[model samples]
Target: MHNKTKLLIFASLLLAACSTDPMQEIPNRGDSAPEIETSDKICNTSDDAVAGSLIVKFGEEAIPSLEQNALNAAKTRSALTRSGIESVDDILNDLHVTSLERVFPEAGEHEARTRAAGLHRWYVLGFASEEDLDKAAERLADVAEISKVQFRTRLYRASDCKTYPFQATANGQTRALVTADFNDPNLFWQWHYINNADQAVATTSVAGADINVADAWKLTAGNPEVIVAIVDEGVKYTHPDLAANMWINPNPSPEYKNQDIHGWNFAADGPISWGQKGDSGHGTHVAGTVAAVNNNGIGVCGVAGGTGKGDGVRLMSCQIFSGDLTGDALVSSRAVKYAADHGASILQCSWGIKAGIYTSDNMFIKQSPMDYEALQYFAAQKNCEALDGGLIIFSAGNESTAMSGYPAGYRDYISVTSFSPDYLPANYTNYGSGCNIAAPGGETSGLSGGEKAGVLSTLCSETSNGADYGYMQGTSMACPHVSGVAALGLSYALEKGKRYSLDEFKTMLLTSVNEIDSRLGEGSKATIADVSIYRGKMGTGITDAYQLLMQIEGTPCLRVALGEVQLIPLTQHFGQGAEDLTYTDIQMSAKDMEKLGIKAAPKMYNGKLMIKCTKPGSAKIKVSAIAGGTKPGTGVVMGGMVITKEFAVIARSAGAANGGWL
Candidate 1:
């Protein structure tokens, strides 16, 4: 909400910049060709498009070399060729075009898929800095070989976001104690993962308003098979908590020797530029939320971080934003394609075009064709065996508007909205039609929790005064939580030997949620929002990790009324034959029992399990029974094979017996 005191407490210090423009190095060969007269037609443009840059798609029938993925072929053979000029290079040379290059690299892993989808035809053309954008576009459009011409537009970037660095002794231990899931001390302050309603965090914090990763951690913390691409700024790969989880390219391009092993820096086309002026580690924070190392007695815990092993989902940094070089369609589109070409199945995109810039997908595609095709290409990729296509998650803009910004508002992908520790929409989070899910992004506006009210994760030591962890808040923070959960869900699916199509998996992800709309009570300390206004606008509800895993496990999620003792029929999970089977025992871990506040020993009665849940959360419990025989048969007796089934017990105030939590 941009509270002044909160800014003073957590805002990142603006780094002094004395850098030169990175775009001046492009070579110009326009002087050697015939000059074309400038056209007077007005440019169909917006303030969002970057100056002096245009993306053009070559027609398949005209420029077959580019359209057919003929990497070594020349652009033109003669001046009378079908392309309207001697070549794309010579033809563009007459129109102030400095350089022309394909947006996607030459014949990579998914080149066939890209070519079939028409993404191979996309090429970026850079013009002289003084060239008029409209005239340049008009001239390019006149070329018969050019199928489409669009201006390069900038994506969202926040180089100076808030940063509250971690300290050794006083910073972490001073907070009131609560059980933490990870050994990292700072995890206690991360109310977004597992809010325990500790007054020390925020007096208004909701008890179960977290992603419910705690219980899911017991089933499967993470699996290394899943990879997520952080398509924002360059990540500090050397950070201790993130280094081990970084994706290693087995066949690294020779140009990227020691550096760029994790992923290439598409922004500068070199090593990750973390030390640049105005760089505030926004990508690092987002990366931490997705796969930061866990239980190593250091930094914060990632949502998919493994149980003290190097088994977390790998993170690949596809940097599109670096310092003053906020991304253009030319660079960012390359990062998206790079993620698909590499082995990333989940794309963690925290940025987008400006809020309200182009609310509809048609407008976005028309204004920025390069980006649209890039995203379309990524969505068609299958990097992991468990999912048919990649999962691309974007943040609903932080503009406090009802309509989420594109490409998050595009509807084809998952758009995340932000919620607070109090379970209300964050003042800056955009909600309504486009938002697909809600997450705890934290809210630190005029609140008593200070930095504790915000989401905490890893940061660059240089940006955070030599500390490698910090706190920040935005829909940017919320998007990664969803990405992390999707990664973990895929990890669990792999463990369970299950597979799903992209659409099938997303339906489970969206349905695996808890109630949020019903919690909009006017409690004075909750929030400044007229939270009731966000009732049905905040997507399905808060995302639940345990519930998603349960969905993946093919286990029935039992809905129980909150704060009440009830009997849940086992038939729903174990089939109708459950009543005929002889039950041996029902078991649950002590931590899980406490997590659900089950004071009574859960026992089987009349083929049903009875228990009381005093709070809201999701937990896993096991039931063992004899399959064939009525009771357990010893060594000499004929008996049924012992069978065990796991069920996800979810407690919520607004759930029904029909299995609908929302």
Candidate 2:
């Protein structure tokens, strides 16, 4: 039924919407190395082949002793030769060692010492056979000049290997079969989807409430529209609930026309499909919360979280992972660049590989120009290529540790952590100096032993065998909420004709956050120093649509009316027995008074307007009128009257506003 209703909404909007357009996608950051022409075709061609994992590092001592190092290298080469190893790229092209240092010298001294102290080490190429590896290490170990010769193993699953279908396992239920090794913790974290529960109280209140959507509307119903770019598994494009909110990029070019579902798949994983109607449910659930079709009386409501609801902004899907196990930072970076290159204002990432800082164990070494440069290059791209320097929201991870994870720990992005409905941080959420904010991810309250997870809007799985609905919790889930709020801010800016760079938006989000509890710990409490550290840090606090709209345009007055009072300047206050200041019901006789300028009353409590009701239950109220034609010389009457106090005068409404008082 929910799907059907969503389809109906999509139908209506599709009919009224403009047609699809073309796209002129920019190329990846730089050109690739020209393919080597192999006349014999003997070299390995697979990106995941073991030969590709060869790692080597050079030190100042090793560089200066070129002949000695080469002699050591020859001994190692002989061992590899005896073991049937075909290649060794470690030999220097020239023995010319220079006294001048290259690369990070300050850090290099520490790195060199760390190596001597058994911290930063060096490695030669890994081989397919252990016997070969041992032989090579033995040859180098025999050389007196060579201080160390170590052989390490690194796994290489083919980059184009078998694709694993998207699957989710939770609470005794499993959505899809695990074709590959699903039990591996590393593999699981690589593709998992989590939840967001920033406002569990408010979210659950509305989710479980019986009130209709129309009445629940506010000035922010759809105000401050946001555009969230999901860079993960592909969304069910035609999924009834998610179709309408998908962004439709308006321009197309001949080279790449009709790319306007505002979505694209970049994962090497084969045959990507929207986990819909026989698909994986991960992307569907995410889409539902981000901008699922709302108010159709079928499924759940998205956090549209603002007024003016035009299908609640838009969602752009950039698929970097599919059923295939081919996901990597390189691919993810491409998706990031794509989202920015297009009009996607904000990017939401829920996937990443666990990689520590560059060390000897890293596939690439710090001093080596080829591989290490490639890894740091992406971080550079995120900072340089993003549109308007758009913000990227990332999950802090579910590990519950002090160690910062990649991308989330990148510091350049908005790292969000998860909180339960009760406002306590989720036990599973990872935290450290990098975490910027926390949102409700959902868990029961009271019991110290309870899960206390975060919660937010949910969606039906595109892959569900039978469209199911339930709650999920994690920092992964918490990220989209911030993303949605960012979208809302963007929409607000667009609607009000205001401009905000990504930096300014970050400023607004950080400062505007409603600090319910000082859960930031003893040392982490926000202070002047912390604020400065976070200057332009966490994007403006959770977006406040009402505040944004009001800031954009001064308050617009509606109609003002006074009940049963005529012929004097209205003085409203308690005359002994009357209700306190708020009881007065002042209605506007005409909304048109907004156009004609007259005397504007005090909105704040400083002065200008006063409320005085005579002596009690007599309950008599008086009102006076002044129009544009009132003579300039007329004396303003400051009239006061006293009557018998009887019953109290309760304020039904409040002020008469600016124009005229009736």
Candidate 3:
């Protein structure tokens, strides 16, 4: 009944998005021991800890007053009373602790939640750069008041792993005629979102290997209510293509208090900046993939980009990396927390902690608690009214290893692997456990597709070889397609008056995929070595946008085997006793038939429609049948209304076992 206890309980509830990041409980201990090093290695190498800095977590006895005084410059220094200061000072001796500050800022949105999570208990200690980091951490850990000491690890913005700058057309502008969904000149090159199979991303192409978002677009373009945070390089919010869909901070809370009205730039501790030297526009490219303004008639398309209707999912830049700026666990921890506080429902991270360092769950959790805690806080947030919790999506490392990188490999969040137009794993993509779903990440050497094989999107003019938009490839690019599809599913759920819990929504998102293992046996663009190696590594096939929406709407899918002929009974759509009713013919457009790879003109035989498909994808068909009458020209001219119903057909590979009716 106490007010303080009630506040703590409320705070704890916010981080209980689902469960703890740890697999099993860690036994509590306050002593500093040499054998069991708890401050996880911040990096994969021996030089893991920051030279002059150490992160310390104080116990309950020492945090109360420090928390109250952390925001006040003068009081913060004095808050560390004699006892606590003397204990730390005795161990440091000559290597004096220069400055002390809280690791995480004053969380306005969920201050109590941050405290209850023990983030407020964590502090950053700066000392002389010459001291041995491990010795200092051990010394601090010996203090009875300090429960944990962390050597903050620094993270680098790895090479984007992109192919040569590929322009769809001569001037980086598309001359192809604009399509119905978007007028963006370069939408034709975005085969990752909607693949007719004809758009060449590489030498070997599959007709329906994309995310299957074309039909999903008809249901809804995108809802501004959904926001995806790009937690990589700074996004150029002023770019012509991404400007409209950028998340604007109307109220500018502490999270958005920076100058870039679009989203805060943690990399610079100021406004979002994508134009610094060495800026690869990696974040800008990723932002465009997630939710660039569509139908703008200038640049490429976004997966959740509005259908020329100012309704795309909002893009929020949570910049952790800029030109030469490197981010660490402490920096990224704040970035992820800021994303949750500022109304972002999805966290799109194209990078992760060291790859291959953590092979098990326990090891990662023990070594990397800060990143884990921040991610948990982000995932636990309920930023959108239509969704119960948030989704954290990351790229499987491009290290060409068997296991995913840390964070993505952490198992609690979703990790995306890369596939090419041929429906096989990218040569550079990491495969194996921790990889959740696969998306088109493009390749470097598609003999025929050339540079166009890479995923194309808006680029920073600084890095686009003089163009505002360009192309890049990697699991980084693949991750956003999943994020965009998630945004689309949420948008559709909102329009249909539906609400879903985080787990339920994630289930639909992962299951909404086409089978890829079937085709993985044969074709590839970059190398043949990855074909067999990727057999079981790519997660749950391809992320299909249409299937996700269909599941959300409770729409049934009629499955058919690819490259096979089947006679479908008309009674399935009409009544079982269709003989009694006046029957008309079934009609399907040539375009619709082509979408499913159906070749023959639709024909009805003995109340059954016969058709064959050469591709694997989803399409809609229309059928008409009369009621209360024998035939159109027969008796009973005033028959009941002609009962017309539409059915959705999804084709699957007969050789593949994972796909079938929905």
Candidate 4:
């Protein structure tokens, strides 16, 4: 039956049968209600509701009737008082009557009304106790005027705060170091930026196996305009390396004007401090990796932190995790919306739903409706003042399985997997086709003598009141690498007056990876075959910062094969005056050809360059073009200007092909 019709029939029945007291007709209920059960699940919130809080959903056409019933029940119960007399005004005063409000209220009434008009069709109804709330629900249950009634619950973070004890001294003495110099003294210890010959300690020959951030830094370190919202635990804005880069809200709402100087703390429902007291510093660590002040002679260098010139990308703390490494899902959803609406270009989330009892084989679980809608809303916030669209990145869970949890598994977001120092998938990182990229999320446990192999960044001691530094390992650490690189890409684009849609930005990030399969063996399996479940499935290889920036520059060098007699096609474009003409402008160094063991000269064949190699080697080939008119003898205008571009050619021998093409 229609809801309105049902409500009318139910109201008529109540009027005809009860006439005097509606509370007396409620079934299966005494003066008090029974307690509900609670669970230990990550987001299961059977016990999270405030003591007297209840969420009641009244049918669209039954709000007035529901209110009248509640008033009548109060009046009927008050009549049974010791005085044996009651008035509607006395009942209202004794019952503490108040208007129903939204469960998750938005910033303004219009926004709240709009959201309520959508999926969230519930209200916050307060009572003196859970019993009162339950009794109200029982009274309304028989009436079709009510759709649903339940206690309000909350969701919290699943990951624990993992801190490394070994990074500190045996005596637990803090190091007193100067941080005013141009370069941080500990810069040499950052292996993810420049792995010195893949050595865990000591700075020697460079391995050049990292994201190649140093080279990209030369082009553009970062711009302050790009804001990356760290949507995890609250960041410690007081940390020196991070304080300079923290984003301050220019026009905060009155409720948060004093507290939200840096960013809003959704968990605490106030300004972004280091969460409630005793909170874990997960968000602070992630923010440091994204844009810690560089060259301040500080502890570490961030991926996109400027050259100590105070020009790094800004950091916003969307604190989802509170005192513990957990928080309410409703609060988290709100934080995401705030980040998207408040001008965050990139959203970095290093936490997600945990796969508690379910193993990798049964990992098809989905996200809640509210959580999914929050992500979708953020994804749709394109054309922000600073960016074309907001990019959402999530950490592939650290479950050591081939399954990723949502929102990482969500198709619209970029999922990042963990790669160890050896450029292999970290043993604990969850991986699958949903993984969009990989970064160095270190493995400190495998090293002997308790070496610090984990990713290093800013940290604050649980006991100490001051800022510090330490190491942490997880897909959490891996996520910010991509976020920072994305900031760099955005910085470059903004510098060059280029605007890319979110799709274009994601395409650039995914396509510009170092091919691990080509470098390592086929499938790019881990060296220890037993734990190689991620073989051929860990996204598009690891992220390459240099390559990504080069692609953004729009002059990427091409690679081709030579020994197989490959044909290289060319599309030549010239000035407006000169059209419909072609010229032969292929150039190759004789020395390079001899060095590469190429016996045949490259010849132009029907608008393509054809080359043959007699032996196995690599060489650089240069291609150039000049414009000419279609009329005879109007050839080679613009003084035969050579638009020289270099391309790489690799010649593989037959013997190598027969074996593996390593």
Each model's lDDT comes to 0.74, 0.38, 0.72, 0.61
Q: Which predicted model would earn the best TM-score?
A: 3
- Candidate 3 lDDT over residue span 1-662, tens digit each: 01222233333344334222132233233355323343432323226656787776665556534433332433333332222355655765556766666666655556766665666656777778888887777667666567666667776543363425545544222233113466776777776765555445554666566787767888888999999998988988889988889999877653334454777777678888877876788898889999888877787788898876789999999998877877777778878988887889999998877577788777776677667778887888899877899899989888888888878887678889998776677777888888899998887565467667678888887666667876788899899999999999999999989999999998889888876666555433347543666777889878888888888887755656677677777665566875445557667777878767787866566676677887666777766776666555437555455677666777755344433211
lDDT of 3: 0.72
- Candidate 3 residues lying further than 4 Å off, grouped into runs, are 1-46, 68-85, 92-94, 156-180, 253-260, 522-526, 559-562, 566-591, 594-610, 614-617, 622-647, 651-662
Query: What would the TM-scores of all predictions be?
Result: 0.82, 0.48, 0.83, 0.68
lDDT of 1 by residue, 1-662 (tens): 01222211111121111122121111222345333232311123735677767777655444344322222223232111122345554656666555455566553344456556666556676667677777677767665456567777678842127877755445443345446567876677778887767666677666777888877887888899999999988888889999988898887754344365889788788877676787888999999999899888887899998878888999999998887887877788888987888888998999986567777776766666667778877888888989999888999878888888878888788999998877667878888868899987877664567777778899988877887888888899899999999999999999988889999999999999887766654433334436656768889888989889988988878766667678878886678987777889888998878877888878888888888888767777889998887766679988778889877888755433443322
* Candidate 2 residue-wise lDDT at 635: 52
**Model 1 TM-score relative to the real fold:** 0.82
Candidate 2, 444-546: lDDT as tens digits: 3332312222232333343443443334556666676566655555555565666755666666654434332322222221111121222222222222223
**Candidate that beats the other on lDDT, 3 or 4, i.e. the better one:** 3
- Residue 179 lDDT in model 2? 15
In the order shown, what is each candidate's alpha-carbon RMSD? Answer: 10.7, 19.0, 6.3, 11.3
Q: Candidates ranked by lDDT, best first?
A: 1, 3, 4, 2
**Which candidate number has the best lDDT?**
1
Clash pairs for candidate 3: none
TM-score of candidate 2 relative to the true fold: 0.48
Model 2, global lDDT? 0.38
For lDDT, candidate 1 versus 4, the one ahead is 1
